[model samples]
Target: MSKFKPEPFISCYGGALGAGVDEVGRGPLAGDVVAAAVILDPAAPIAGLADSKKLTERKRELLFVEIQAKALAFCIARASVAEIDRINILQASLLAMTRAVEGLAIQPEHVWVDGNKIPTWRYPAEAVVKGDSRVAAISAASILAKVTRDRELVLLHQQFPDYGFADHKGYPTAVHLAAIEKHGITPHHRQSFGPVKKRLEQLDLF
Candidate 1:
């Protein structure tokens, strides 16, 4: 009955603990959509909390550890490139967030989701714009998601040398576009994306 935060998600749900959810890799041309949910301890002090995009990799890695050590519960989940292409990126992102939240050992009373749109889930959810920076729990979740996804993309770089997955993490950078133009798309590349679609058109292939 209490009013939620004016941000994307409502504050806490009734009296249940507040869980924050966030994701990364939506804009990538390759790699999976990774998401994380974190429940921060109300008693804990949240220092140095900020948006994952605002922090350096070292900072995010450090905060990630702190969040893991302090959070009441947390979980990370991913939806692969194939799933993204099949379900569409938006749905895949929501699916990834849902999986992350559901994987929590205990269900949260309310979930504060980052971004303007809320996912279709049975649990109570609050959609917060820029929630990652506004909410400590969401910020922690963002750090976890970004760090985990970035690490995976770094590993993928070894498998696909031409696209420089490690460097750009499948973003449609000039290098990535050039790689698509030269070698065409790999299984990891999202063929549905614009850059990949344009490149395939030039080659007269799908």
Candidate 2:
């Protein structure tokens, strides 16, 4: 998918100037949930835009820069681990998405979210399932959110190399599970998450 021209079919109920939104790190045991909103520019077409999970790190990095340079406007935002614990992952994810949309350099007429659920917001918004793969602007948002979260996790890795955050980006991979088993939980881990909560339970059992 190269350039996505905003069509009436795409925003059947939304206003003009549609902004796509997506979130990353929802399944991670650590790191804040990151979200991004992007309003693509029809005049400046970006090539090779796809779901960020499908793209290699190199491809994502390349597109991350291109998206920022070519898109009409984009914004990345996050909900902290603490917020996730307080409000739960789903709400925190939406909050981050809402924040991302609000931070846009150009206010969008409507927010096109990449999932079945839309956040609580005053503006008009629509949720399209699998939108990251279907919508160009949503794909751009996925790229930015994923790349930004991964970059931040790498920084956290430097401080806590034992968790191998740089390699797994705080996901619940085998290596990460092993690291958690050995090292226990850190402040960075989302205590509200199952694995982290289970780990805390085992510790309390002792």
Candidate 3:
């Protein structure tokens, strides 16, 4: 597992204070879409930063705390299921990222966002393809967002054990789809998603 190094990109931007943004839960059928923005302290470097999806849950959980403690600024934000259904997932994701950046304790001079599209915000920003793997700050943001959302799903699981939210984290896996078919949709499920929509239609609730 390769670690992310943001020095190259940071140097390219002339070492300007910058924030890295990333989001999670876009593919999930339930729960909010969560995003995180992190500004790393160059003087205090952290090791083992990598894409959140590539890290184990334990690694992510550990880094999640380290990031908050060492980062110059970090913020986690989310778009509710209702917001996702209203604006569509892509726009909702952008909205969440925007909110995360806006919520940061310290503003950044520039922003590096994971993926090809960025939010329509005032900050000078660049979208990096596979940024979470290439940039340390982006990787930290990814870890924060993923761990935060996964914990929420675990709580949701307690409320609706039949959906198995803890196991799949609201994703439309075989077990999750089967559970939905058996137990019906919950309030947290994203009705706009295909699987959830289909289930809702079958139940004459959509």
Candidate 4:
């Protein structure tokens, strides 16, 4: 992929700030859909802000702290696993993003979401493909979302060590599949997800 080049900040709202939003955990087999909204402080610009996936865990963690401290406004929110199963992951992810922005301490005039689809919201919002990499605020939101979800998974490992949520982060990896097959699904697993659904059917759990 080409290196991200952010376009100039353009907000048509009446002297209001623009919040960048992004979601993580849409692809996970388990866990809530986490999202973040960040209104960056132009004066406190953070270096090394890029797509969260492009950075190492250590780097991402460092930036996560920096963003929390330096951002003009930031909010982290999530759609529950039950909501993900009921509304589906796409809608759940969007809902999470919307919630993140809505929860921000500072109200924003516009919202820039990192994706092709926009959530149902009254705020002036637009979606940009790969905005997480192209937009600094979106990148910061991505880092916050990713780090928050990863930390949740690590904590979940304490309750269910067999799934190795700390390692796979709820993705359908080989180890995760093996564990699911051997131990069955947990309440955390999304029943709507294919792997979890198939396993539930196999075990006649559903």
Candidate 5:
């Protein structure tokens, strides 16, 4: 049997000094855009790793711990709903990613991003589609970003009990849509999202 090789679009970390960047919550009607950059420890082995979307919540939670434990350095950052509304989700996500990379304890020589569009930062980077599933470092980054965003939504549930944030995690589920239709959007809702934007238009609120 032949061993699988990474796709051309997917760039390796190149030795032990590269960073992986990924973001979560870009499509949610609520919650902040969260991003994570991870530098994996040379000795670490994160097996069965894939994109966070392919993993169950239980699996993601488990990997989150292991990744943090094995990472040489990691940083998580967020662009709030207000920021998202001001700059749009894509830019906000990029902003969050840039912030995460900037905040890392050790700077990286190169960065591997998990999407086709690279962030506007001055660092050298390559964006790979589905990179999170192919690159261990990107997978670790996805896990951390997802886990952090999930925790934030869970906390938001406490403040806005009507939204069921703990369960939906700010996704555009029918239940979440119903909640928005009923209770209207909270301050945490992304005002720029179409559904939330329409609701805000009707209510004439910022």
Candidate 6:
């Protein structure tokens, strides 16, 4: 169990219908940026809520299931590689988070986003420096987004075994960079990213 206890939405925002938003895969070289919005049910308090990065895979998987089952409402959304290339990773991340919050079954009175910036939206929202660790709803949202994106990368690994998506989850690791140098870029790779763009330029030179 984690020693950190996340603050409840009702206590932080003073709202019964508050949603927490978070995004994952922003730094990955491949795959879509995934986001999630979660409205926790105060009646069903989940234990051990913490930042997704702080939790092990097994723990996150367990919490993913629990959050889905217990949350009042939750939505997972994504911004495609094309969208990321068209707009930019940061904008795409915020766009995905916006989609997540908009897709929620129950609209929230206020939204708490996990980062330092909130997307352009109409709902009352505030950005928390480390909401995933400090806010219960944000922790749940982070778990959902992280688990969802990780699972997609695992699936991508099956198709491109040489890239080892399952191992590094598409981040620009040395092995992934080597694979790009050897196998070249895939359709799933974000062409706008620095590493991918440079690799593409190098390939063009050949």
On TM-score, the candidate that comes out on top is 3
* Residue pair clashes in candidate 2: none
Tens digits of per-residue lDDT for model 1, 93-199: 99999999999987888889999888888888888888987888889999999999999889888888878889898898999888878888888877778887788
Best by lDDT: 6
Candidates arranged by lDDT, highest first: 6, 3, 4, 2, 5, 1
* Per-residue lDDT over 102-173 for candidate 5, one digit per residue giving the tens place of the 0 to 100 score: 999999888999989998888888887888877778899999999999998999999999889999899999
Q: Would you estimate the TM-scores of all the predictions?
A: 0.90, 0.91, 0.94, 0.93, 0.92, 0.94
Query: Per-residue lDDT for 104-198 in model 2, tens only?
Result: 98998888899999988886888988888878899999999999999999999999999999999999999999999999988999988888889
Q: Identify the superior model by TM-score, candidate 1 or candidate 2.
A: 2
After superposing candidate 3 on the true structure, give the runs of residues whose Cα lies further than 4 Å from its correct spot: 1-12
- RMSD value for candidate 2: 3.7
Q: Report the poorest 10 consecutive residues by lDDT, candidate 1.
A: 3-12
Show pairs that collide, candidate 4. Answer: none
Give residue 139's lDDT in candidate 5 (0 to 100).
91
lDDT of 6 by residue, 1-206 (tens): 87655454334468679999999998999999999999999999999888999999999999999999999999999999999999999999999999999999999999999888989899998888788888889999999999999999999999999999999999999999999989999999999888889988988832
Q: Which stretches in model 2 have alpha-carbon errors above 4 Å? A: 1-9, 13-16
Model 4 TM-score (2 dp): 0.93
Task: State the RMSD for candidate 1.
Answer: 4.7
Question: Candidate 6 regions off by >4 Å?
Answer: 1-12
What TM-score does candidate 5 reach?
A: 0.92
